[model samples]
Target: MSQVTDQLAQFVVFILDQERFALPVEQARGIERWRTPTRIPGTAAAIMGIINQRGVLLTAVDMRVILGMKPITPTRRSRFLLVHEQIDCAIAVDQVLDMLQLDLSLAEPTPHRGTVASRGLLPTPFGFATWLDLAALLGSINNG
Candidate 1:
């Protein structure tokens, strides 16, 4: 007899710097094609700026820059991953490859994964999490 099993994970997998990473789906809004963002003043280097997604202002954050990697200059291929965490709204990524349903049973804390050691962020058994402070991210927006 063959066995079938179901897997569960609370995150959405994304691509950045040609690497596979994940973020909590609870906070994810959706993904969009590349669009020029209106840069904000006096914000962290990682903060790309504001973008209008269907009339909603989304703060487009460059994941590479947030991860301490060199930022990619905006390109036609660039995309945005809209997410909201503890605030009205915010953006968390520059590009997305695909949405993956991670299996928590096969998942391990990022810190425990030597292959992903270079990635500063860590994933809980359920999914990957950002060390970026929510207050700090929200504060960047005049109103989030």
Candidate 2:
């Protein structure tokens, strides 16, 4: 399929801390307000914890630490984005932004320096997106 066609379809756009981030819309199950996740002992610091969504266990990734941003302090403004990467995972974000058709031509490659495995693509032209590479992001997390 053409890149434009792919871009025009659905996508999940969210705020990771103060920065705006967009991933191909399909990766997310849905976006919702932040919930107090059940903390899992012995997990990596970036893996904040997990949450049970309608009987399914969802892992929550703390984007702030993952992206080298300041640690997130739970507050009334906290939000959770239900992202389904390999398994059902909930990504804690500052907020859920609106969804819109992204323009492929304007899309830029993710920078190679970010903590995110796929840092190449970023949103642009009032709409930006990066193809979601879940395994790469998760694998980068040190289990030990």
True lDDT of residue 87, candidate 2: 69
Q: Which candidate is the best by lDDT?
A: 2
Poorest stretch of ten by lDDT in candidate 2: 1-10
Candidate 2 yields a Cα-based lDDT of 0.67
TM-score per model over all chains = 0.65, 0.79
Give the clash count for each candidate. Answer: 1, 10
lDDT of 1 by residue, 5-91 (tens): 465544556555666566656667777787777898898776777888888787677656645567866666566776777654445
Judging by TM-score against the true structure, name the best candidate. Answer: 2
Compose the digit string of candidate 2's lDDT tens values, residues 6-116: 445545566665667776666766777778888899888888888877888888888767667787787776777776667677778776667666655655677643555
